[model samples]
Target: MNAPPQEEATSAARVLVAEDDDAMRAMLVRTLRRAGYTVVEVEDGFELGDYVAMMRGHGGTLAPPDVIVSDVRMPGLNGLEALGRLRAQGVACPVLLLSAFADEETHAEALRLGARQLLDKPVDLDVLKAAVRDAVARG
Candidate 1:
């Protein structure tokens, strides 16, 4: 695959996406790929762990991705809790939270845990793409 464009590549990035719904996940992959990013797609927190492990295995001194986009709710593990765990473990990738709608407490917890963006459901694809792009850039 070609390297991501200068304007779109994260400062120290590779984008990771975590969403459970297959259709939504596929749409996200297609959208991000079409936008010139090489996105690492995962279905849930376990898969996220696997991906992160693989990255750490090969990501070397650079560590893992510069940014992550995650769905808020899922079975087995919820995004907020998993990300909090990741933070505790020092993953440090800036995260963007996506959900249909979350309680204020969930929102506050995400921000408190260092989420870079929190988006409601029925997302605007253009905005989602832009948020990912910008978040990656910032990272």
Candidate 2:
């Protein structure tokens, strides 16, 4: 069988978003989409893992996302833990972790786990966009 067409295989720089708050998730999806990225939205870290697994299960046939944006305090595995797991599994996409609680330990751990940026809650859209742009550029 022939491989899918390149245009069909890839869209604009892809971004995976895992935010537990419905409103926040919607806003992020809208903003990222408006910014010309293909956005995949999930409710929590577990769902984010599932999405990653689905992509990986296709072997290297699928194009992994350029960046991930996740909430720090979500159900199941938190953003940092999830990012660590993905890294362990050889997923190199940069992650931007968002949190309302800005604990030093969490920040340190997130950095250790390879999060590109940790933005506090009520994140400025411009800052968030800039961070995502930087992450994608880094990759």
Candidate 3:
């Protein structure tokens, strides 16, 4: 017997979320969970980098998440910088960034960093869900 498509996809799909705002992070976790994804939360970009490093093995087995959703403006090591570090380290998981204020340069830089999408703050839940699903499917 096989599981339904949605269940099979979401059950094994791990999503790492990096956001500094407590309320916003909670909302994101709740939303992703309701959408059936296995979610991991990190409060800032530094934590995000450390987790990614650990996932890259740290002398263990490689266990990268299916996708990463992050806030562009974190307290330290912002999302774009983290993404650059991940690329430098050869961790190529898809990334989606959230920003309350993204300018033209920011958008261009995000694209250069290979981010899948740059979603604005106060994001629509449905849009976020769809983007995550798309990123997972593409991976």
lDDT of each: 0.78, 0.84, 0.88
RMSD versus native structure for model 3: 2.3
Candidate 3 pairs with clashing backbones: none
Residue-level lDDT of model 1, residues 1-139, one tens digit each, is 9978766454335678899999998998888878877778888877876665555534544357667888998765678876776777677778889998698988998999989989888778999888987787666
Can you tell me which runs of candidate 1 are displaced by over 4 Å?
1-5, 8-13, 53-63
Residue 73 of model 2, lDDT score: 93
Which candidate has the top score in TM-score? 3
Per residue, candidate 3 scores C-alpha lDDT tens digits across 74-120 of 98779999888778877788999999999989999999999999998
For each candidate, C-alpha RMSD in Å? 4.2, 4.8, 2.3
* Residue range 32-89, candidate 2, lDDT tens digits: 8888789988998778767766666345345568889999998877888888778877
Residue pairs whose backbone atoms clash in candidate 2: none
Q: Compare candidates 1 and 3 on TM-score and give the better one.
A: 3
lDDT of 1 at 90: 74
